[model samples]
Target: MDRSSPAGNPLPAADRADGGREECASEVKAKLVGAKRWRRLRRLLAGVVVLGLTGWFALPWVMPWPAALSRPVPAGMRITDVHGTSLRRLLAGGMRAETPPKLPEIPKALVLATLAAEDHRFYRHGGIDPVAVARAARDGVSAGRRVSGASTITQQLVKLTVPRARTLRTKGLEMLTARRVEMIWSKDQILEQYLQRLDYGNLHLGPAAAAAGYFGKPLADCSLAECAFLAGLPQSPSRLNPWRHADRAVKRQQWVLNRLGVLGWADADSLARARAEPLKLRRHYGFFMAPHFVDLLLSSLPETSRAGGENLTTTLDLDIQRTAERAVASHLARLAGKNVTQAAVVVLENSTGNVLALIGSRDYGAADGGQVNGAVARRSPGSALKP
Candidate 1:
């Protein structure tokens, strides 16, 4: 080979060696950069987790905001008809009570039964119950999912009042609201309002209404078994309904009764007997006392009208209400299962919205209001629920 051909121009050995060293250095630097980036991300995630735990455990204080500035608009319930109603019904001194009021005062027994059943420690605990949450967490882990509810009534109130898109962020907001609601309302106030306004609590509507609608008596009159049935409805309103799923509803009712038994409000034998009995729904689902009128009335109203109001009685006649329900139930014998299984019957006085016979469900014990249409919805399709 020629010792020096210009075309060959062999590079110096030093130059080749320097090029190799530079490539090695670049690779080393790339690895170091990646390690640092990974550490930074881990730190960011850690910070988020720490903040959530702090809020959850510490249950940090929430500053009060004015009701006007608060989230929800006013709660409204509109009454349609008013013929024979004593809008001027007297109070203690033969005076009329407040108009557009809340449900009749909660019964002491219903209150006691709920307390005995739902939260024995409700009186003892502040906003959050570490023990209950821990138990629920254990249950969730055991079930391999979040099936248990660790929320207290206070927590539920927070969710109900604070309207937010459901998300992690919204959940945080709910906790924040719950903490604040705890500060503002007393335990009794919270409990009363919760039951009175509880959505899905019953077919006739709020708890007081539900007690009245179901037992055909006042909240004060709920039997131990009946109250157990009502209390259990909140957990899974649709599934464990005493009216439809007499069995499942009985199961849930038993849970409440069991709790009551544990709390000393009831005896084991009483609870067992109640559990074994079938739900005796006073009226057909959604039938109330007057089936045809209710069907006609609900069909006449618009969607906006379902909005509830206190003292909004209908013009239904109790005697006539029974007749209509019997007619339908008798006519649909094959549907006895489906009728009691799922129904919504609301009977009203034709002239007044004063519900003469409001049977929100067939198996008032099990009906989901929405489920029963025993007489079926029988309303106009595509038309609003109440106009």
Candidate 2:
């Protein structure tokens, strides 16, 4: 239908031009709104598909962990027990190799403490924990780098087996291997391997050496408090060396106790007492484990030992070695200040020429000097032995 303005004549060209421009503007707004709606719908659909694919692809990588793990000791090598006090074989005993120590010598209380204190989700997560990963990611974002670790107990076991961490490449490889281990081995098997491969100086590997070191108790006979103490050591043995820093050792021990508390393994009263208690420093099993031959054999050993298939026989008459140490210590009071106040004794088999008994010193340590091997170390005879 034709419309007319108030003016009697047909509308002027300028009026017509104004009306056309308004119509054009309305059409442009409609097209722009339609385009925006279409774009938003596309974006929403894309997001859903992406999420679905991500979940599908991540299935293998983020699936639940395995149920069990198999033990991996060398095919025929027996897991030996060598705690010498009882009639049972001692961990470092000269006579017997070792069989595995039963799961928990002390209690679940102590073992859980160590696992929690060192790693809270050790058993619950896969080789690595996602919560830890998220935490690490947050730290990285805020600080421009990582502050926490993502490695799980299994990953640590893999790293532990590596024995060296020279590069990122090596670490990545260890994580890969740890994942494989988680797939194949049971949790107990992994735990056993970790215990077995653990570093416990002087060819004495595993918890056995560690138990022998701190408590003078065999791995199997470790008391509740003692196991907590020894298990706490590997986290930082040197820094918390009981002999060097009694305070550090005590703190670590308490930290372990606290770990027990976290796992609800320790009682409230015991936790409080352990935390408040002063360091009850004790001589480590250094002498008790090896007795007479400890210092001598250690001095003779090279910086690093190679544990190939070669069976090396030591030079010690177990009976005689025990006797010599007792004899020398008893005689110390009579011989305290003769410049040669400290004494060492060595016995050798006449036939095999094996240096058997080597009692380095009455005291476990040297004269405040940095680690002097008192046994193999021969102080000049001082003209004592008449020529």
Candidate 3:
């Protein structure tokens, strides 16, 4: 029952059907393998997405809070005169700025200026500003590099507390920590903390110190111009230092004032006046009188009290100390030709045994054993002490 084709031998329909069946089986197997591979790829992608979501939700809780926030602020003890005038500032560590003021004590103008200069949307944002971020991203893309920043005040505080190199990983951690900080602290508390730890030029740590050191006044007494001047310093303290680079500082201040005017925080008259007002920047190295006496008093105290937060008021009077210093200097000048290289003056009150003045040497700043406590040193009493 075989039939012959035109150019072939006899062919059977059953063989042709068997060959067709084999081809069909091959196509089905290939399709099944492709489907299995697609399923495996989808599973892998789903696992990655799940892991990413889990990490995003759990990062803040897993990351530890910054230790610097919990640690006590490093403060120094103060030594004052009987009239409560500061005679010397003694710090166990590096030099610190003046004590920071509370939120209420901070000046309104300064706050406004700071908000305008640093973060205009500080109150509205949680820890990041989406609008600013988008703008910065777009700008960066156009510039082919990072041209601007979008860090909120909260994010800046986090960065200050936990410093790290500039990288995507560090920035991600900073943003996460900033969110956590905002959740833990209120708006006022976060702002106050930021002001307390903010670095303002010349070792000044806070606005209080900046006011005192730069303006020779309290934070509450700072004028609008002064406030603007100080507000501009936190951007680049060293570069905009009022003492060192007044021109740059004034430019920055003008910028802040302009921002304030634009924000309607200050009227035109006030902004104009601030721009015209001259800042009387004071260069204060802090009161450093009665060095020898202060040394003795500190030596007598326990290490804890010397470096503690408490201020010590001594029985010494500042006026009498000045008088005694002048008298010693004049007398030493008179005896300059008599080989008298040193002199010690000690003034005591008759009513009380308190020391009115104690000068250890003619010049405490001299390099030749000037720090020797001559008043307390054992020496033969000359004719001046004759009975």
Q: All models: lDDT?
A: 0.58, 0.59, 0.84
- Relative to the true structure, candidate 1 reaches a TM of 0.51
Off by over 4 Å in 1: 1-104, 163-168, 200-202, 267-278, 284-387
Ranking by lDDT: 3, 2, 1
Report the alpha-carbon TM-score of model 3 versus the true structure. 0.78
Candidate 1, 1-387: lDDT as tens digits:
223335777656776677668988999999999999999999999998998776755554553443522432223332323344322111211111122124246555456666765566776776677788899889989999987666677767666555568787866666566666666677776776566545433444456446644555555666767877777776676776556776786677767777777777776777777667665667422223333344556577675554433344556555655665676556556676564444445555457555655554444334355434445445566656568
Report how far off residue 353 is in candidate 2 (Å): 17
lDDT for 308 in candidate 3 is 48
Candidate 1 vs 2: which has more lDDT: 2
Give me the candidate number with maximum TM-score: 3
Q: Write one digit per residue (lDDT tens) for candidate 3, span 26-129.
A: 99999999999999999999998988666545566667799988865555687899999988866535655565578889999998999999889999987778
- The weakest ten consecutive residues by lDDT in model 2 span 74-83
Model 2 C-alpha lDDT per residue in residues 266-292, reported as the tens digit of each score: 788877765664544444433343433
Cα shift from native, residue 185, model 3 (Å): 1.1
- Backbone clash pairs in model 3 (N, Cα, C under 3 Å; residues 3+ apart or in different chains), count: 0
Cα deviation at 117, candidate 3, in Å, is 1.2
